[model samples]
Target chain A: MFPKMDALGMAGAVPRAPQQERSRVTRARLLEATVECLVEQGWSGTTTTLVATRAGVSRGAQLHHYPTKAALVMAAVAHLADRRATEIRAEAQALPTGPDRLDRVVDMLAAAFTGPLFVAALEVWVAARTDAELRGALVPLEARVGREMHRLTAELLGADERRPGVREAVQATLDLLRGLGVANLLTDDSARRATLLAAWKQQLKGIVNS
Target chain B: MFPKMDALGMAGAVPRAPQQERSRVTRARLLEATVECLVEQGWSGTTTTLVATRAGVSRGAQLHHYPTKAALVMAAVAHLADRRATEIRAEAQALPTGPDRLDRVVDMLAAAFTGPLFVAALEVWVAARTDAELRGALVPLEARVGREMHRLTAELLGADERRPGVREAVQATLDLLRGLGVANLLTDDSARRATLLAAWKQQLKGIVNS
Candidate 1:
């Protein structure tokens, strides 16, 4: 029923508050659905329709929020990066100081690979390689992750960014972890993953001590 | 017109040897063209028609050799791995044993990232993430590369697989290199690249000396 009312009654008549909350909830649902689709179909097959259907919303509503599939994908990527940054910061902080720090960093880094979010990130990366627009959008996220990684490793090693071999080792370690992510995804071997992680920590320790 | 000839003369008339040589040349040309296509258009965009046109061969002839696009991409990836193996072996042998080994390894590893072959391989890797067939074909190649890296690092560090920390560090360094490749492909900062390489070597030194 529609109503004509005075000031206090008119304020209640406005549905803006509930509408805003519903919009926020729908947006979050869509983003989460996008991640699930990425994990299932990768970047190549993650259509907007799939994301909308997964989110239990109509295609029109999905488009109303995201405008385009690229925008949706970009938003999903940012959501993932924010989540990962929090995990990394928390894990890095939990590590014991001195020699034990190396073990903690290695464990945390290795743990990052076992989740679906990282897999989605890899899909985004592959998508970015060919899409200039996606690449442009991804640069800030990549830089932020890289800077965080450098900071985390430096803190763990008790070395500054300028310390000899710190940057190189950090970069190399990130590469190895990325490669391992691909490897772990392709195969079903946990032992090999463990071996790789252990070998990485040893190398990191060597770098820090040297 | 058909020519009537004796059996011995007919055998000579076939020109089998020259035809085989020509086929080999055509195959090589096709592979070179495939690499070019991959570098220009990425794995998803590269097609048999495009590769045939780039190689200046008929589409029929290209298919006669490669049979499928997957076969062509696999061939390109294999050729890349072989070339990298040769370079790594040569670089490793050229370096004097001990601390000098790390420098030589970095130089060779650097070459792997700065070239067309690595770029092509990166495309193959991206393609493999979604295509089960491509992933199946790439597993052995990835394993071979990993083994080669392991062997080279073991030699450089004078550590065996039994030393878990040494192996872990080596693997982590490799991950960093892989991550750096992604970064380098996306960015144009040479100074940052240099810093990454320097840090890698310093990390290696620490691992080796320890």
Candidate 2:
């Protein structure tokens, strides 16, 4: 049940502005709660009603923003992923311009994949496998997120894709980190991951450097 | 709703031997059907009744072998994964032991991950994220499967783990392939995969060849 917009609201008067702001706040709450639910309960367990309860909003208000579970979860993940991607880019700004910059960049990227946002996005990804509607929404969102990560990784590492193996090497790094993220989904693979990362950084330096 | 075994069958006589064989056959059918269901329907959409119907077995027969959905699907994936892992090892025997060995090994391992067995296992994997009981059953199964692949890869690459970066290099290869498989689930990523594989094989050669 949507809130009724009065005659002045219909005419776009300034007095109805607070209603618009309240609606934005409510929508943000729903999206944030959706990501939390996805991370905590997984896609199958997360429901619109539960999200509404978690967000402390009325079920009607939640439905007004996200009519279906698919739309709600997709939008929630996309919104959160964009924020996380931006955070990754922002975090890269402080990195040292030294020989270890690739190492730091790899560490930063690995941290992004192992965090709650990746977990939440992973839930949607698995669900989307059988749900074409979710897949339709997820594919483009993931492409944008993935491309942003790739470009940012290249920027932080200062690698020239014009070099022979540079592009694929960067991709392998992302793929490896993603795989490490998947490994961590089941258990803490940090010990083995540490060894692998150390080894990979040495190898990546060779390909990314010249 | 199990089939009633008569006194002759209860005695475990030679005449009742077909009962044992028939039970094995029925189990194979159910397991095969479960994998098919998982690949086609994903974890959430798959149900025991549906698997039974697909297998052309009575619900009683299916439940007799697997008392719960978790048990059924987990058993299905584990059984198939074992077979597939064996197949990967067997297929390796035909590979030429030459300069291209590493390339073929990576391709073989990547193929294993992109197949229906991996897809089915992936469904259980994601479902297990939310279901503790399923995770309890899956973690050990996956550990065993993962170790097998790792050992096989080490053998195929002839890498001595005593050397620095050798063990981690093998793992990185598996992780990279798994990540590539994840990328392929939603769409065809063969082109990018080919490129990444090319770059990684060259790197792998350096680590594996001592």
Candidate topping DockQ:
2
Query: All candidates' TM-scores?
Result: 0.79, 0.90
* Interface Cα root-mean-square deviation for all models: 2.8, 0.9
Tens-place lDDT digits, model 2, residues A18-52: 88978877877888899899888988889999999
True interface contacts retained by model 2: 0.61
RMSD over all Cα atoms, model 1: 9.2
Instruction: Give the per-residue lDDT digits (tens) of candidate 2, residues B125-210.
Output: 87888789889888988898789878888998888989888899999998988888888888888999999999899988988786
What DockQ does every candidate get?
Answer: 0.40, 0.60
In angstroms, the error of model 1 at A64 is 1.4
Query: Which candidate has the highest lDDT of all?
Result: 2
lDDT of 1 by residue, A1-210 (tens): 656643222213445587886886688788889989988887778999999999998888999999887889878877666667666776677667777777777667766765787888777776676789988988887787668766765665566557666666666666666666765776664687777666666666766677
Chain A alone, TM-score for each of the models? Answer: 0.78, 0.88
Error of 1 at A56 (Å): 1.3
The whole-model C-alpha lDDT of candidate 1 against the native structure comes to: 0.72
User: Which stretches of candidate 2 lie above 4 Å from their native place?
Assistant: A1-20, B1-17
Off by over 4 Å in 1: A1-16, A88-102, A152-172, A202-210, B1-16, B87-101, B148-170, B206-210
